[model samples]
Target: MYYKGVYHLFYQYNPKGAVWGNIVWGHSVSKDLINWKELQPALYPSKPFDKYGCWSGSATIVPGQGPVILYTGVVDKRSNEVQCIAIPANTSDPFLTKWVKPNRLNPIVTADHNMNGSVFRDPTTAWLGKDRLWRILVGSKHDDTGLAYLYRSKDFVKWTRAKHPIHSAKTTGMWECPDFYPVPLQGKNGLDASMIGDSVKHVLKNSLDMTRYEYYTVGTYIQNKDKYIPDNTSEDGWGGLRYDYGNFYASKSFFDPSKNRRIIWGWANESDTKEDDVKKGWAGIQADVEVTFSFSSLDKAEAFDPNWVNAEDLCAQKGSKVQGGLGPFGLLTLASKKLEEYTPVFFRVFKASNKHVILMCSDAKRLLSNN
Candidate 1:
């Protein structure tokens, strides 16, 4: 995916077989800022570090003696408490093609018996800077509420633990995927605009401005650098960051040190309308969007603003918007007929007996475009 000008995307795919057994990284590229083409797998379950499964992880290209990188914590079914780092095997396309080894440093971040499995998983690694060098946000269940762990890395290889989030009643739900960054606020004029992803169509459409936000899709993170305390951060009125309201979850934000700008992206959605991942042979999909953030002050209120750009803007198709019947929606029929095989349109649906269900795809997406 190309952001601003440079292209970037790391692959998250299962390698060994069709099952979620061994996950590895795949690579891709683009130039005109939107179009992208598939490349090969970048990181895979290799020797000491990733033998179990490469699992899910993000990429950080920090200024090192050369290029810097850190990803997730995945353990094979064979061994427990396994933590390792994989070096980029081929620097040509760093996003794809990686070689693994137990960190010469070994477990830059490790799990403790005190910590449980629900948390302590995938690490979204990014370079904040030299002093704030490497910042890793790992899924964690430190307090009763779900949270993430933060670690700082000065050198590309060595990492020091940093502040962990203190939860609060600011929002509901356990924190998992986490992202932190500044957004461009709209000029002091009208309702500050922020692009919000539509859960109904599973694509991001512009929505209201957000001063602070958090979610399960991007997990959760603390916005204020100060007032950050490590232990027992989950307290009432403790204050946390959420990106948007409604069903938008699992959002990840990044700051481009070079541009002095902040940007965010998220899982387009959490679930695929009751379709079984085990059966579709594919699990979750990254929302397929790259958001651009700009700050603004409106109504005399000061706030950080985020503007979202979606696939609808990139690989979006322009045709008569399809309208279907209105009710609940589902995928396959009890008779085992596939929907996508039939038409490229949205549906209006209703639940029926256990087997025979009817889906109408021609009359109701417009609540107000009614004729």
Candidate 2:
């Protein structure tokens, strides 16, 4: 998160070993988002609340209280998951290098006897409400149902679980790393977590532990009712739209107040064998950033159909002659250099009744090699 003049990043790490066991939050700071300097572990197992391990959570900046971190902690050897909080040891430190968990308020929220303690983890960033209460969510599951449990606080310390979950889905298994925030309905700018109005919409994204894919829905937050109702544009179940079609999970997004945009971070699982992982001494937990480029094989194929064209010439068009309205625009690939065989892989955005629908497709037909 960008705070003060420095960008602070807190991530799950194992200080005692290279592998996933001895969990703690490794802290790092940067002036520019690129180059970073590592600081001491921001959070680790110390008290009874997080004695076993320290896990994922989020940071929130309060108006006059500075930044507070809400994280899931393994309370005992049984691996009971509980929500906990940490405060900066010195808010004056520009990097906010040190943090301390108050014992009195440690393990601020514990699972009820009827709730499954093992699956509860990953609290989202907290947001203030119209009722002057601070609210947050913790991911959990109950007998094949994924849940985002809601908890509210008056002072960001003591938390009380709501009568019902903020949201849930049956047969989806556990929901991990749940994220909730508001976005401008018509603009690209991001809204603060607490922002609510007719011009704004809320998005709730959850990483499905069973499928290892992140699913999100654009919805409305009925503040008075404390419920989220997703628009009909997307499904809110296991078969819903995903953040990525492949290996990405436990995603987190934060609004960049500085840039007026939202930034997302996710972990990508390694497809390689375990033998290869131990040899490398690490697993694939990484930031996700991708880019794609398209080119035609034929130099003069400007028809924009399944015609062959050189990639260079197509890119040279610079979108000058391209018509734009939720484009399925992209280059036709696997085409013969003579402008013969090709396939189009593109994305189209459609205006739905309540939201925009994006569809990606690749057209491959039986084309004789001779052609």
Candidate 3:
């Protein structure tokens, strides 16, 4: 979340080790988003609400009250999750280095009688509606259906759960780091979380815990009804449009008011084993890559096979080496001078009956050496 004149980042961190236990919100600030300076752990297991662990959450800049964080906290050994809030100890400070959780509303929202506490986590950035209520989503699951439970607040303190989920789909399993925001239909600029109208379209993204991939749907948000309807243009279940077909997960996006665009951050799980990570003294890193592709035409594109329902399976069958009408085109990274060994990150386009099906593959299978 960008605050004042600096960009603040709060992430799940293990202060004791490199491999994912003893979690807390590690804070860092940057003037340009490129270079960062680390701060003390922002939120940790001090109060009973987050005694077990301080997990994933998002930051919202309240209208009058500076920035406040809404994150999931594990309350007990059962791994029960609850939504909690934290405020800057000193909002006047430019960096907003210190933070405190108020006892009055530490655990602001929790699982009700109908929901399972263990599955509820990752509250999204709160957005205000035209009716003057702040809305937020908490990720969860019911049996095989992934859910984004909706909660509305008037003062950003007290909140109430809606009768039904804002959005959900079956067979997706647990949805983590759920994000909801609006994007302008005609321009490249991004809209604030609260922005809604005929000129803009809404987006709902979720990280599937079962598949370890994330999918997003561009659609309409019925604010008055507290519901979201995904467009018929794409699938909403397991076979859906993914942000990345690779290891990206738990992504969060925020509108960059300074730049009039949105920036997304995600975790790419390490390819190495935990034992290897411990030996290296690091487990994860954040990355950003931008690429432009040019194609002559789709006239020669290969016909897409309807039987290729699973993207991962399709990529496995027709890899980068396999040529096609429109693709098997992209860059080769970490390559040797001889071209005998390299990792190919590319895309393949298959001509479906009505629309084109694109497959993005970052194949490390052909990588000959780690060096």
Candidate 4:
């Protein structure tokens, strides 16, 4: 959330190790998204409500309250996922470095004993309703049916379960990281999540744990009935429209009041092995874009070309290097006029367990002058 000209980002982190365990709320602040400064863990395992772990959640700026957080906490080692809240101890500090979770109001929301506690997690960022109440969605599943259990609260503390979910789907499995928000039909300005007006539509996005895909529906939000009905064109099942066809999941969207636009963020799973990730000391890709390259004749380079380039020498060089096992390669380079100094970029393909694997590299050692 953007507050006082600074952007605050809260994410799930493992304080004890580099891998996922002992989860806590990791906080960071930045004026621009490009550069960031880390603060101490904003929220962690505390009180009986969240003694196990402090998991995924979001931040919101309320009217009188500067910033409020609603997160999922594991109450016990059995993995009982319960919703909890944390408020800033000092709103005067723009970064919101300190947060206090009152013992009395610790577990703000919880599932019934009959429901599966393990599948109930990831509370959405709460939104104000037209009835002057706050509403939020918690993701869960009944067998293979995905569910977004809706809850309403006059005050952020006390919440009551709605008779029906805001939305649900069959055979979608667990729906995690459900997000609901409003967008104007014809303008760049974003509407508040609870905004009820004509000229506007609501969006409901959910991450499917079974498919590892994030799907969304854009349609009308009936505040009077407290239900979300998708448009005829919008499909709700696994084969429906997805936010991304690739490795994006667990996405959350929020209104950027400063820009008057809504922005979304997602986690992208990497296609590399776990050992490779551990060797690199990272698990996911920050930028989930696939870049392809080919050579040009004019300057022996095709700048930013998405299609495959035509480079005979590069292909020959690669084929010879690989002993005719793999073909159809290309060269990319930026060289000086005298050809004395050059930087060559290339890709090599190899057959790995009946699948073609690509190894991308820049031959700086072979191209650059030793001196």
Candidate 5:
């Protein structure tokens, strides 16, 4: 009944022959949020508003309506303000054929009065508390304070402005599309921000929270600004927006009403990641995760050492109780993934963190290769 089902993904892609990238949104179809099939583009950038690119954005299912889209329509560098574009989901072939044009209500947002009008873009949409109102987290001010500009809307189309910007150092430095919503405690990382993110620890009872992964991208927004500080912050108290480690960005999440989940994924490609561009082969890859979140007693759950099991040793931990998990846990490296199914492939940090391993069991895969 949901056409493409509960979720669909659209990312910035540069097809066969275009400028290095001309802003065509490559799409993928998914029903279970697990397996995904790469489909042709769903949207293309040609019009005056988004002539340069149809950058990152969010998709909202409109119940009796349709998929009300809210995305950044990035124009040329001369005036690169991201415009808002909306579209209905059931409009195209979706396999590699025609693309859908946005509706008449284009440019729901243009430049912001608060930040540098030019850098203010990448709209992350979500419910603004219980007001039934909506909010867009626009990353702005690359010229000086780089911050996530907060703009609220009563109807998805109309807009309002927040009293303050997320001026915290954590939220500054060229903050791109920011996805925000309250989530429950994930696991335990002491009092650190990881406390909530560490929530994937207990029984695999699915909740509307990160049973596994979710994150945002960041750089120094603007030499840090006092205005960006949260209201609750005291001079000494620790408070500021936190980066999702490194190596993630331009991310936005959709609030799924049907499933009661706020699922998200990032481009996984950043200007900073330019180093790995050559080594990884693919210019960009989607974050290998589907996330849900909660906001209750998050620490009550027992955490699992997701990275504890090496990809090759997945079978070994089949029945083993998990110790504190680590990523790329023990030989779960890319080298081990060449053959067949990799087990216990619960979480991948992508970059080598504490948890990265690829210990092989049979060596049969390697034995033949060595021959």
Candidate 6:
């Protein structure tokens, strides 16, 4: 989130090693997004509420309060996830270095009797509604169904779960790092999470644990009814619109009031095996890339096969080398001089009955050598 003329980034980090473990909220700040200066770890397993681990969550700048973080805290050995709140010890400090978790309301929201505690986690950035209440969502699942549990609070401290989830879908499995926000219907400008009206459409994004990919839907948020109805423009579950067709998960977006636009980022897990990571001593890297593409026409785009339901499978079949009228066209990154070891990041266009479907592939199939 952008605050006090600086952009703060908090991520899941394992201070001890390259692989994931000993989770804590790693902190970094940047004047420009390109360069960052590391700060002391923001939140760790210091109190009983987060003793086991401190996991993913988001930050919201409250109206009166300077800034608050709502994160998933694993309280015990069973991996029971609960929503917890933390505030900057010194809000006046532009960097907002130290933090304090109030014991009175540390675990502000927990799984109800019918819900599974282990799978409940990742609170989104809270937003205040027109009705004078703060709202947030915690991701979870019931059996084969994914859920975004909604909670409303008059005061930021005390929260109550709604009778039903704001939204859910069967077979999507556990939804991690669920995000809810609003965007303008006509322009690139992003609406604040609290914004409501016909001029804006709300978005709900979920990271599917079963598939290890993130999917999102543009829908109408019926605030009075506390329900979300997705438009029929795309599928609601497995075969839905993805933020990225490649290795991306646990994405969170924040409205940058500075730029009047929303920014999103996600984690890309290591492509290599666990053994390879152990050998390398480092498992992953954080990166950001933006690309622009232009095509003369879509007249010769391949006819999208109806059987191509799974995008990853389709990308594997029609890779970057395969020719197409409009695509299989994009950049090759991390390449060798001979171009034998490069990762192809490209897009392919397929013609459907009424519209054109664009498929993006960041194929890392050749990242490693057999030997």
In the predicted model 2, the residue pairs found to clash are 295-311, 296-309, 296-310, 296-311, 297-309, 297-310, 298-309, 298-310
User: Which of the two candidates, 5 or 6, achieves a greater lDDT against the reference?
Assistant: 6
Ranked candidates, highest TM-score first: 6, 3, 2, 4, 5, 1
TM-score of each: 0.54, 0.80, 0.90, 0.77, 0.57, 0.91
lDDT of the structure predicted as candidate 4: 0.76
Q: After superposition, how far is residue 356 of candidate 3 from its true place, in Å?
A: 9.7
The C-alpha RMSD of each candidate to the native structure, in angstroms, is 13.1, 8.0, 3.2, 9.9, 11.6, 2.9
Per-residue alpha-carbon lDDT of model 3 for 211-269, expressed as tens digits?
88889999999989999999887789778888878778899998888988898888887
Cα deviation at 311, candidate 2, in Å, is 25
> How badly does each model clash, as a count of residue pairs?
35, 8, 0, 0, 37, 0
Instruction: Return the TM-score for candidate 3, rounded to 2 decimals.
Output: 0.90
Candidate 6 lDDT over 126-241, as tens digits, reads: 98888998999999999999999999999898999999999999989999999999988897887788899989888999999999999999999999978999998778999898
Using lDDT, give the best candidate's number: 3
- All candidates' lDDT scores? 0.42, 0.80, 0.90, 0.76, 0.47, 0.88
Candidate 5 has its poorest 10 consecutive residues by lDDT at 202-211
Best by TM-score: 6
Stronger candidate by TM-score (1 vs 3) = 3
- For residues 1-371, write the lDDT of model 5, one tens digit per residue: 12444457677777753224566777777777778788778777777778767776665544355556666776676757765765654455433234455556677777755456566666654433344555556666544344566676676776766666644232224555555444434432212111112232211100011111222222221111212222222221112222232344455555454555545465444443544654554575554533543335323233445554233344344322244232222322234446443222333222233433322222212221333
Give the C-alpha miss distance for residue 132 in model 4, angstroms. 0.5
lDDT of 5 at 189: 27
User: Model 4, clash count?
Assistant: 0
Please tell me which model should have the higher TM-score, number 1 or number 2.
2
Candidates 1 and 5 compared by TM-score, better number: 5
For model 4, the run of ten residues with the poorest summed lDDT? 297-306
Candidate 4 RMSD computed on C-alpha atoms after optimal superposition onto the true structure = 9.9
Q: Model 3, residue 247: displacement in angstroms?
A: 0.6
TM-score of candidate 6 versus the correct structure, residues matched by position: 0.91
Clashing pairs for predicted structure model 3, backbone only: none
The model with the greater TM-score, 3 or 4, is 3
Off by over 4 Å in 5: 1-4, 17-20, 89-103, 112-114, 166-171, 185-246, 255-262, 269-281, 286-329, 336-371
